[model samples]
Target: MNKKGYSRSFISLWIGEIVSEFGGAAGGIVNGLLLYEITGSKEWMGALWLIYFLPSLALQGISSPFLNHVIKEKMLKNIQLIRSGAYLLPLLGYLSGEDYITIIGLIILQCLLGLVQPIYASLSFSLLPDLCTEKELVQANSLLDGTLRLMSFIAPGITSLLLIFSPIYVIYIISSLMFLLSYISLLQIPQNSVEKIATWSKKFWWEELKAGYFTFFQYPHLLKLTILSSIVQFAVGATMVINVPFIRGELNGQAWEYAVFSVTFPVGYAIGMLLLTKLPKNNLLMYSGLIGGGLSFVLLYFVPTLPLAWACELIGGILFPLFNAQSAAYFQREAPRERLSQLSSIRLLFLRLTMPLGILFASVSFLGINTRLTYLLIGTFIVLPGLYFLIKTIINRDSSAKHIRNIV
Candidate 1:
């Protein structure tokens, strides 16, 4: 498909992503705030996210094989519609008057959202190629990424303002509406030709699932990259549980201050996106991103004030895009298009699988730790993987040099 430009389809998807990012970001704040208001425990927070992560990752692994047969845009639209519906569950729960029932409702809502997110994400990822050319792929991805981050950055400020005028539940309503808008925007995407896939037997479905896993193993480099990325995901999961508590409990901050702290990272991320395209593309730079990003969190752990913590988040955000954008581009370029959807799901499965573990790690009260220490621990986990790979590359380079010298 010699697609000449960013056609209506890609543009539509781009707009949808923008709206969706803001919606998701705002809703994330509401979730944390709402849960904390009710339970006041980091353990519940961890469990909340675990509910999201466990099924989300499990389904990503389970559903990879069938994605190829699915019509990407239609699947995407359905997911958005479902997401919009899911946001209402919490709002409905709150209105029902029973505290226990509200918590259970939120849990069920998270479970359903988790079930659908990977399907939407993976389909959208694999659909991009059909919408644009190789030259445009990186640019397209960068635009989508930067916009998402920028929206996330902007959403916090908006959320902070909204909180002044409205109750927390209103955010869920807004989020639901945003997803509806995203669905409406996506409706503008031009329909593309899709190949009909025959239904395989139960045994064949199992075979396809195995083949998807085997493909990841077959491409050792992809597997390696996915593992390295997962380290950061694990840390992010921990951070998700700790960041709010670290600000509120340890730093003695308010919702506004936490909002500022959250915005700083994505602001840096937006700036980082600008730099990502200008910098030289290499594995070293990408690896450095993991190290740099991890180091930011480590710095956050030691920060004595909100301003310093905000700075750490900003720097981390800036550092991450260097890795995130380039790694995504590499995968899109390398993965076989026919199997790309399957492989991308497998990749996402790897990335998202450890997040729940990280949450558990952070929430382990029996470990006798604080949020600051949790930050340090997870940051170290992220850095160590990159450090290992960097050292391995150096060792292999020196070994090759010695072999050539001996041959000469």
Candidate 2:
């Protein structure tokens, strides 16, 4: 696709992503609050998080062949319908006041989300070839990231304010509307003539599935990136899972403080997105790990006050997106388009699997140690393996530079 042609689709998807992210953020906050109200147990709240993640672990390999086999348009339409239904189910439960069934229904809804997300992920990358130049991919992804961060800035606060009046049904209405909009936007995308692989015999499906796993091994750079990303994901999940409890218990803060901290990360992320045009993209992984990871930990350690903690989060937010944007661009640049979806699915599986472990470990550490010490321990210990990979990748690249120059 030409630059002019790509712009039209890019603009549409960009708008869709923005709306969807805002609605997702709002719905997430409301759902958590409602669940807590219904169950009156932190365990259930944690379980909700776990349920949201478990599908990723289970579906990674299974989804890949299906992703490759299905038509992108058909896949997207089915996904939208599934997601819309998932959104509506909770509203029904909310109105009925059947707490037990509602909890079960909500778990089912999250499971549906887990199924649909990889399809969306695959489609999103597929669209890039139609919607962007190779050179524009980084900026395009940055725009998407920035939009999400901006939505994060507003959604929680808006949802909290709305919760003051009515929480449950409001979120349902909002989620439904957002999904509706997303479906419409997806419909606007022009279907591409994708080359389909010949139907494999029954034996081929198994081979294709195994191929997805082996593909990562064949691409060492991508393999390393995947491992590094999973590590970062684990760290992030641990922080998020513990953050609410930390603010509530250790700091003796209110819900508003939690809202503020949540908002801070996005604010910093917005700032980071703006800075991407000015910075070199090559060293993003290493720089983000050293700066964002280190600063986040330091803030958790020394910043006892809410205001100061927010400041640290803002700084960390600014640096973190650099890491994410560059990593995504790296995958897009290096991976074959036909296999991108499978690779992404596998990557997500590792990430989701490790993230819970990290959160579990962090939670256990918090049981015996002080919260600040737990933060320090995770920052120092858990995050190091990923950082080590990033450092190694950077050094290897530097070492290769001189050899390439000599060859030139």
Candidate 3:
């Protein structure tokens, strides 16, 4: 820890993450907006996300076997540079003056982006502990998680403003430049010596992967926490699909209304981020966040008007960071430093693997269920498990306390 309470490296990495997240978020909004303009199909919007998720997960599986050998900082810089190039590719297609070709270019961009995102995300998540002391881990994680979300909200507001005066494609141009800046900022981090690389052998690689998974499963709390977190990710996936449509389709909103609805969650998230550091980091708080967030969704199911729905999202956003920041810090602190990167990827694989399932769940109108009911279902999924964990944690604590008292 530094006298300023955060290391210079963490500050550097945090700034880079913020810039990169903003760029990514801006590019994402542009991708959706441009693609929707071209196709005007809700199904295609879902498909675009699938293109990103499927390839990303496949790469995560392929890359996890070898992550222990890679240098984190170098790989982060390389991925950002590649992302910069990838963001620029669609412009080339636009310049070529073919809508179909531009669409194909966008698919190609998404595929490349999918390939790199898992590695970048896992590396950065695992690398934070190295940048900050154990004491600083929770704050660091909160800062990163909170700001990444804040950027997601901030980008849309910025995009909405820019759309008023400029073209949507212009956001992509800005995004490409933003990523380049992230790459430059990443260069400030001093590199560490690379870990000893494992020699190549088919059998050896397979065994290493099994060992990573085996070790991951061995940590019962970690496994449990991961599964619980996966439920939230599932809810998140559904939200990603439902948020815009629910606000626009069901509530009869336009771009400005959707933008306002979008911004509130992250605005609440920023406030939660500030509040998390002042609160206790424990299972009770984490599970409360899970339950509170889920209830917020259930609240939306019955919200009779647009303003009420916005408040539901705001409350959900505020409630979730309690779990997100603490759980992330716990994962970083719990995983062994030597294997942290690989384990982090494995953990992410499990968490991310479910989101597509959730997206698919949300995308499909199962049995005539409305979008609000879909939100209710996803929320219920989160709430039930949260209650289970909350009860379990309390029971265990009471049992431990009783045994202590009996022994005394």
TM-score of each: 0.80, 0.85, 0.90
Each model's backbone clash number: 0, 0, 0
Instruction: Write the residue-wise lDDT of candidate 3 on 1-408 in tens digits.
Output: 246788778888999988888889889988988888888999999899889988888889867767888889999999999999899878777778888988998999999999999999999888888888887787788888888888876777787799899876688888898899999998988888386667879998989889888888878878888888898888888888888878888889888888788888888888888888788778899899989999999888898888998898889888899888878888888877788888899889989988878878888864367888998898899899999999999999999999999999
The segments of candidate 3 whose C-alpha lies over 4 angstroms from its true place after superposition are 1-3, 32-48, 96-104, 163-170, 244-256, 365-367, 406-408
* Clash number for candidate 1: 0
How much lDDT does candidate 2 score? Answer: 0.73
lDDT of 1 by residue, 106-196 (tens): 8987898889889888888888888877766666777788788788668877998999999988999999999999999999986674855
Candidates sorted on TM-score, descending:
3, 2, 1
The candidate scoring highest on lDDT is 3
Candidate 2 lDDT over residue span 258-350, tens digit each? 888888887777787778766766763445544465558656877778887778778877776777777677778788777776777676667
Ranking by lDDT: 3, 1, 2
Q: Itemize residue pairs with steric clashes in candidate 3.
A: none
Model 1, runs deviating above 4 Å: 1-7, 26-54, 85-109, 163-173, 244-258, 300-306, 369-376, 391-408
Model 1: weakest 10-residue lDDT segment is: 1-10
Task: Name the candidate that leads on TM-score.
Answer: 3
